[model samples]
Target: MEIEGVRTDRLGLLLDQFDQAREMARVRLAGLGDDEYLWEPVPGCWSIRRRDEAVTPRAFGPGEWVLDKGAPDIPASEYAEVVRQAADGMTVAKIADDWSVGVERVEQVLAHTGPPEPDTSPVATIAWRLGHVHSNFEGQWEWTFGERKDPGLLVDFTPSAALALERFWASIDRWRDSVASVTEEQLDTVGFSRYPHSNDAECPYVTVLAGANLEFIHHMAETALLRDLWRTRFTTSG
Candidate 1:
C-alpha cells in the first residue's frame, strides 16, 4: 500500500538512504577493537567511560521519540554540544558482525553482559549505553513496520548484552518487510502510534519513521568517527 506521506513510494526511498548510511558505518567498525572503539579524539570529550574518580560528570540521554528540538542555524558552541550529546556512537554492523548469529542474540549477549556492577567509570561498555544505542532505530521500525505498544517497552538485552541485540536484530528482515508495506494514509493517521507526539491527529507514524531515518544516519556518522579515532589511536601503537 502507498504510505501516507510526502508520497506513497517515497518512504522506501527515504529508508534506503538510511540503510545505506548505516551499512557504511558498519563496514568501517566491523573489525575495530574494544579499546580503540572507545577512544574519544576531542579533548574533554566523552566517549563512553565509567564515572570513576568523578573528575567529569559523564552524562548520556536517549534521543528516541523526542520532538525535533530542531537544529541550529549557525552551529553555535552550545548548539554543537547539544548535537554531540544527542548522538549515540554506533556502527551499523549488527547481527552478523555483532554479538551473535541472530539479531535477537544481541540482547541475549547484552543481558549476560549485565548492567554495570555499580559506580564504575563510564567505560566503552556503559550500562544500558549499548542497548540504548541499538534501540535508537527501534522507533522507526515500529512506526513503519508496526506500532510500539509502549515507548517505554524498550527492547532489553540479557545474558551479557546479547539477548536484546540478538532478539531485536533477529527480527530486522521482518521489520524491513513490514515497513515496505506501510500505507501513506496510515502514516498521516493521527493516533495511529501514540501521544506526546508532534502529530496528535497527524501521520505520526511517518514522522517518527522519518526521525528514525535521521537516527540511522546519525548512527553511521557516529560509527565512522569512532572507527576513525580507533585507527588513529592504536593502529600505530607499536
Candidate 2:
C-alpha cells in the first residue's frame, strides 16, 4: 500500500528508510532463543534476570523486569571530560594508537564505556539491549504521537527475548500506521511531540522522526554485533 498525505518526496524517502531499518532489526531478532538472549558472556554483565534473581542495584520502579545497570554510551559530556583528563587534548587518533585498536573501536569505547566500578565492566546481554530499543522507540511514539502523556512511565525491559521481539514488532506496526497518517503540515510543525527526552521542544516534527530512525538503526546494529560475538566466543570454546 502507498503512503498517504506525503506532500514531499523527502518525507516519502524518510519513511522508506525507516522501513528498511526496521526490516534489518527484524532480521537481527530472528532465531534468537531464550538461553542466548539472556546469556552474559562475562561476570557483572547487565541482563534480564528473574525477579528473585535480579541483581542490578539500579531501581527502575515496579515491574516484572529490571534493566541491568549501566546505560550504553557514556554521556558525551562525561566522556569529553575523561579524554581531557587522560590525554590532555590528544586527538582521537592518538588515543586509538595508544590503545592499540582501530580508531573506530577507540571512539566507541571512549563514547560508551560504563562508569567506573570495582572489578566490573558494563556488558549488556542481548535481552537487555532488545528491551531497551523496543521500549525507547515505543515510548517515543507514545509520548510524541500517541495518547501517552508520559514516555518514561511506559518503559518495559522485558525479561524474555520473545516478549521483546513482540513488543518491537508491535511498535513497528504502530509506527507504520502513524507514518501513513502523517500530514505534510504536521511534519512542518514544531513541537509536535512533547517527548522530554529529546530536543523535540525546539525541533520540527520531521527531525524527531528522523532521530528515532537513527536510534533504531544503531541499536539494532549493536544487538547484531553482540550476537556475532556470542557465536564466535561459544563456537570457539565448544
Candidate 3:
C-alpha cells in the first residue's frame, strides 16, 4: 500500500512480524502458574524477588518486588586507566578525585582481574524474561509514541505470573498500536524514536521497529524453552 506515494509494504511486514511474535508469546505463556514462572532450574538463577529478599548486588524497581539482574562490572579499559593513574604516582584518593568516582570504585578497578574468560551469565527464570520483555516494550512505547521520558531503572517486577502476563501483553498492544499509527515518512525518518536505553536515536524508525520485533521474538522463544525445561525437569532429574 502506498500513502501519498510512500510505500508502506515494509511497515506492514514489520507490523505482521510483531503481531505474529506477540501471538506466539501469548500462546507460550498461557496457563503459566507462579511455580513455573519463578522456577529456578539451577542454583543462582536470576529472577524477580521481593525487595527485601533480593540477593544480587543491584536490584531494580520501585515497588515491593525487584528484578535481580547482576551489577555492572567495571570494564578492563577502566581498570587499565586506574593502573596507569597508579603508575603515575596518583594515590587511590587522587585517582578517585580525578575520575569523580568513589575511592572504593577506584580500588575495585585496580583490583579487578578481568571478566570471566567464558561468559557465565546466570540462567534467567521466566519471571525475569517476562519482566525484560515488558520493560523493553514499555520503554519503547514511552519514548516513541507517548511522552519521551526516560524509563530508567524503574521496572515493575511482579511476583504474580498472571499480573506479569497481563502487563507484558498490554505493553505489546501499546507498542503495536504505536507502530500502526506511524506514517511511512515517520518510519524512514531518523531519530523518530528517542529511546535512550538503546541506539534507536541513530537509526531510522523502521530499523528500530524491526529490531524491537526481533527482540520480542528472541526473548519469547527463550521463555518458551524455559517453560519446556521446567515441565521436564523432574523427569530429567530422575
In terms of lDDT, which candidate is strongest? Answer: 3
TM-score ranking from best candidate downward: 3, 2, 1
Best by TM-score: 3
C-alpha lDDT of residue 138 in model 1: 54
Candidate 3 runs further than 4 Å off: 2-8, 73-119, 153-155, 236-238
Q: Which residue pairs in candidate 3 collide?
A: none
Which wins on lDDT, candidate 2 or candidate 3? 3
- For every candidate in turn, the CA RMSD to the true structure comes to 15.7, 9.2, 7.8
Q: Candidate 2 lDDT, tens digit per residue, 5-113?
A: 5434657878888888878878877988888898888877777665567786553524777666543333443455446524556577755554444777557756665
Sorting all predicted structures by lDDT, with the top scorer first, yields 3, 2, 1
Off by over 4 Å in 1: 1-8, 37-130, 139-153, 157-173, 195-204, 234-238
Error of 3 at 114 (Å): 19
TM-score between candidate 3 and the true structure: 0.75
Alpha-carbon local distance difference test for all models:
0.44, 0.69, 0.80
TM-score of each: 0.49, 0.70, 0.75
Q: After superposition, how far is residue 232 of candidate 3 from its true place, in Å?
A: 1.1
